[model samples]
Target chain A: MSLTYGAIGWNRQKKIYDLVLACGIVLYLSLFIGLGAWLNPGATVETLLIRGFGTCALLLLHIVLIIGPLCRIDARFLPLLYNRRHLGVTTFIMGLAHAGLAIFQFHALGDLNPFVSLLVSNTRFFSLPDFPFQQLGFGALVILFLMASTSHDFWLANLSAPVWKRLHMSVYAAYALLIAHVTLGVLQAETNPLLAAALGAGLASVISLHLVSGSREVRADSHSSLSSFDGAGEFVDVCSVDEIAEKRARIVTLAGERVAVFKYDGKISVLSNVCQHQNGPLGEGRIVDGCVTCPWHGFQYLPDSGASPPPFIERVPTFRVKVDGGRVLVNPRPLPPGTRVEPARIDANASG
Target chain B: MITFAKWKLAIFGIYLVIGAVFAVVFLAIGIARVDPAAKGSPIGFRLLIFPGVVALWPYLLSRWIGGEHAPRTERNSHRDGSGGADQ
Candidate 1:
């Protein structure tokens, strides 16, 4: 969405989002530290802070993980997906704070370097009772740091979306490692059934959300393939013009890629369903200001040219489309990105 | 805390040394060469990606040496399969 890079591309919405996020984080930390001190009078303030930051980070990470699938399940959750990188970066900072405090308390006073001590201070990896849980936490933190450092679009542009996506997808690995870090580290010491149950519940919820949304995607892809597919070199009959609400799109898979057939202003525009930003679902987006707006980050592309309006350079592929007998038919092949394709005009009487 | 093993210490030393050296070179010369957008980007932005560049120095070094730039090829299953634009 920006022509040049800066520290952040903050807008009014982002400023508000960050303000709310900061307040929530401050509120959570204060409450957690206060409650911890009240419950465990023997624990030091540093210990309470370490636990508070660690738990807060974990909770924020869960929210970060949940936002993606939640949006997929229901577009109503799209706003949460908008500023997710900010949440992710905040999560990493919290994790880093916790690690910093823990290292200073446990390892820094010794003769060995803190990181060196962290790695070698525990070699009980084979024993479940005395596992190197801190190391697991450290591993997870490294993954998180990598993700956090590269969270900006600068990296996304340089890394390319696919490579960037693959790197960020290691969040699952980090989550798994943290689960082990928690289960083996704290759960081993804290014999609270409540903690174990909570961890299990969190894991189950994440898994369940992914499964439900993933199956829905699979079903959609399968449906598109089965119902609309025609042989190559032929226009595939996708859906009736009426099936797509005005200013919205009906997604169809043609020749193995999804395209969004949009109906607006008595015409139809078919475009690749991939958002140039983050590969977000363009089909799920509505036309805003006469341009197809990506629901994820609000990146917009002209329906006709598949290019962002002037001064923004992002583009997506366009498709050849037409309407006959009120049925929308689209060529299975994608034109070059930013290629202009005249929209098929809808017959007012037939569409009615 | 435990006593450091010799090999572990050596490995850590090597990493820090290489990381320190690479950090200077990358911030000064490599990033703008590798990515045009990084050219004239703010100091904070360079600092932001510093840890990643340090950690990924070897891979990035390969890219830098090869004068490779990752074209923003919007690869999807459909695009790859269909020979779509910029594939």
Candidate 2:
């Protein structure tokens, strides 16, 4: 959103976000280590550190995985989404600390290189009790490290939003790896069914949240398909004008391309559902100041032209729209990006 | 046993070399893309993101070389149908 990238463009909200996150991490670690020591008086400091940080990182990762779905389910959770990358980076740091301490304690003094020992010391990859679980953890750590490093908006801009999103989606893979790592590594050694159950619960929670949010989105899309075509097929009927909320849109997929037909200011404007900036859902975003604001990053475009207002050069394809007998009809063919089309105005006396 | 140890050492050495090369390239890219709002020295930011740069260098390098600059609007396909579906 800025012309130039600064350290983080930290504002009051971000500072508060980081401070709260720091305090929470410190509190969690203190309680976890304190409780572990109280429970087992003979537990070593290294063991406490390893377990505390590992559990903290895993917990934070569950939060990270659920944030998107949580936001989708409720708009109130959007604030968490705003500073989610910080949470991710913090989780990676905690995971790294846990890994580093484990390596130092378990493998540093060995004759072989610690990493080599990690990789080759346990060759029982398929064996339940002796499997090389550290490798799975190491693989997950690598993925998390990649995600944390490129969590910046600079990377998002440069890599393109779709690519950046795809890269971040690899977190699911990392999650799977970590789950295997823990189930095989710690759960086996500890002989604790509670630990296994907790991990299973986390896995279930993440899956359920994603499923719920995904189903909601699919239902919305399905509703948009209830349309009839005109005799000429030149303009497809999307929905009735009354079906659209003011300043909102009805998104329709026509000929494989999605178009957002917006009802605003007693006029209808059709534009590509994709935002030029991050391919954010323009259809899902409400109009702000006569422009469609992208829900993801607040990037704006004039609905008529599908062009970002001056000084911002981004553009999305526009579609020709018309209102016929209270029905909104949009042409399947998209106009060249940045091409201006007059909006079809609703008469003052038009009925639903 | 000796041959096995030598193989392990060889693999470790190769990993170290690769790690060092990635670290160096990461440092280079970090300097170029240091956050403006970041406080403290550029080196600090570089160090912070060093691991990320190393792991994501291939993708970052493609972006660094102008490979990812195509506008998203131009690439939209009917199969994908743009935003809400993918998200």
Candidate 3:
């Protein structure tokens, strides 16, 4: 049907984020030359390629994991939710580079040899007694390769979020396999007890934090602190004007929910207590460099429009506020972004 | 993003262990072989975990950990429906 201006703004923001990522990728990859000189101590093209690709693969994994909770904790993360496929594809490219170097560094020789080192290197796959087991890591890496190759928007769009989600759910499977990859291959081939334990613990910790956070969120969903504001058509009584300082703000409970009302530059404004992003309380948050920041995700909003920063257009409705004779009155009338209203101006010169 | 506090210290501990393992293994291999240079592959190899671990971690974590909590309970979402919010 019809396209809203908010939609247009989101498209533009995506483009800006993409461009910045492109610049970063280029700059980061170019540093291989400097790294080769420092790390290898002698100039060799093979060493440079292998080390660079290895580092790239590691970094890509971090970026891929970062986007999800970021959005969950904050509503502003919705924009990135749509662009997640791009991130997947990027991670896949890094995996390809790592694999390419791996083949070249260890397995390449002049012939139609079929590159047997892939399955044959450690000899653990033969299942004979005293086998090294690193062969399992090789197989696991192959599975990782397949998963990486399919990471794309074409697949996600065609598969739908659930099927796509199910397929990507294999990441945990892939993670388990990668753990086998490290323990079976790197630990056995490398033969260092401390390193093996360290790698195992690292992956374990990441997984554990996820499990704990997931459990906490399960309980958190049933309750909303703002539920009291559930509209018996009753306004929450916070305090007298004497209690609120000049050019400042105070918070109160209305219904079961919280609301923040600010008297700034002698004008009154009201907004939801929680941030549209990470649920950061507007009451505890502050005006930083002129805009209100959520403290949790740094989401900023203007009191009047409740619109997010430029290049981003998500908006939260602003409610009506009135100061009647010395009493504060808040009507739960929320206007969509761009609505203009005249607010009563307090005398800047008056002390009380 | 990562909560970045506890996760980091754990990762650091992991790195130290892996590094020490590589160092010890390479040393042992060097000592065992009479001519280590001739028999052993000089190529230093470490673990290469596929890139997707980073990408998939957040989505899985949030899905399992964060759940689908309503973004903010501000306006009545179903204002058009009866008894939801006074328009």
Candidate 4:
């Protein structure tokens, strides 16, 4: 209670504090009296605990994914994001409880070993021949483990922002896994058509939003490429020395894709105009300390290499550029696919 | 004067939490007569079964709360940026 988060735009934090406190009280009451004592189908303490935790974990995953697009679609929904981590961690804890109790309930029935049951529990290794839905959640559980474990800034700092961002990008994969887990495991295993459809619909909403939103960025990239001056082959449009101010980037469209061409320290560098993460428009982002930092997700790209800083394996396509007679021109011809280029020499930089 | 969407979501959160907690608790205690009263109630029954009630709690809560969250703005960028990244 001693910690106080300072005011951030119209004292929003304080209101959230009050609201969350109220919610917490509600949670306490609901859990204590309404939640009642645990009941088991077979009616054992272990069984009840396991079921309770599993339910919590699945539900938490659903809620966590829902929050992001929710707030984006509506600013008022922003309150949910503040406490999203708590929800995710809570789910992990619930999942752990379920897994723990399950070990006792199913595997530890009489004389079976705990560790043996986990790995040996119906693991379907391939999707070609009947995918294992339970194993799918297990995979989700692994990503969640990494995400939840590394949620703090300590790990983030230790991993460096680039590495941390790369690690977190794995959540998209985790989301895909959970969808499979629910579709195959929950729907297939449980045979609950309504819940399955509902879960599917919910996931589809997110995916659809991403698809709808994502395609626009893609289209924008394509649009930029087609609309702008083409500098295919050797012709390039490197910005003039005077055109770029410090920390600002101008986007160039070549061959129907948007690429943010940055000028920093008298050097011209090109990076994909579309952010790989969430497709944040790179043109809108600015350079920070010689690195192009994405306003969204704080993803940083070395304008020179288009590769994320060390310990991070993410990359974006970079292009060659040249300034022609006071006009900036970029070569539409991309460097070889998967080419990771470091600082290319600019005439201005060479003169300097 | 609060917005209707906020009001709806709040109501949804309240009702969902109520419904989920009740349902989960009911499932945990209703079906089987197992009792773990080591603390206060009694120390009679000591069997275990997986109560499915808890898992559905969050989902129901999300449905209730998030379900009623009336889709507000219809802006194009809203679809892309979505407020999750703002804070």
Taking the tens digit of each residue's C-alpha lDDT, what string does model 2 give over A1-352?
Answer: 5544444657788899899999999999999999999988999989999999999999999999999899888877877877788999999999999999999999899797777677667788668888889989998998998798888765676556778889899999999999999988898878668888999999999999999999997886676663467888788888788898999988887655567889999999988887766566788788999999877667898989888888777777777878877888787767777778888777742555
lDDT tens digits, residue span B1-87, model 1: 244465776876788679768977987888888887677889887787777777777777887888986546667765664466631
For model 1, residues A1-352, the per-residue Cα lDDT tens digits are: 8776787888998899899999999999999888888888999999988888899889999999999999999989988999999999999999999999999999999987777888888898799999999988989998999999889887788777888999999999999999999999989889779889988999999999999999999998988872454455478889988899999999978767788999999999998899988888899999999999998889999999898998888878888888877988888778777889999989743553
- Each candidate's DockQ: 0.49, 0.22, 0.02, 0.01
Q: Where does candidate 2 stray beyond 4 Å?
A: A157-163, B1-52, B56-74, B78-87
Report fnat, model 3: 0.00
Docking class of 1: acceptable
- Second chain of candidate 2: TM-score? 0.41
lDDT per prediction? 0.86, 0.78, 0.49, 0.54
Candidate 3, B7-86: lDDT as tens digits: 55457557546545543543344211322122332222111111222333333234324443222223333121113332
**lDDT measured at residue A114 in model 4 versus the true structure, 0 to 100:** 44
In candidate 2, which residue pairs get closer than 3 Å at backbone N, Cα or C atoms, i.e. clash?
Answer: A5-B36, A6-B36, A6-B37, A7-B36, A7-B37, A7-B38, A8-B37, A256-B78
TM-score of each: 0.93, 0.82, 0.43, 0.44
Candidate 4, DockQ score (0 to 1) = 0.01
**Best of the candidates, TM-score:** 1
Residue B82 C-alpha lDDT in model 4: 24
Backbone clashes under 3 angstroms, per model? 0, 8, 17, 29
* Structure candidate 1, residue pairs in collision: none
Give candidate 1's TM-score. Answer: 0.93
Q: What's the candidate order when arranged by decreasing DockQ?
A: 1, 2, 3, 4
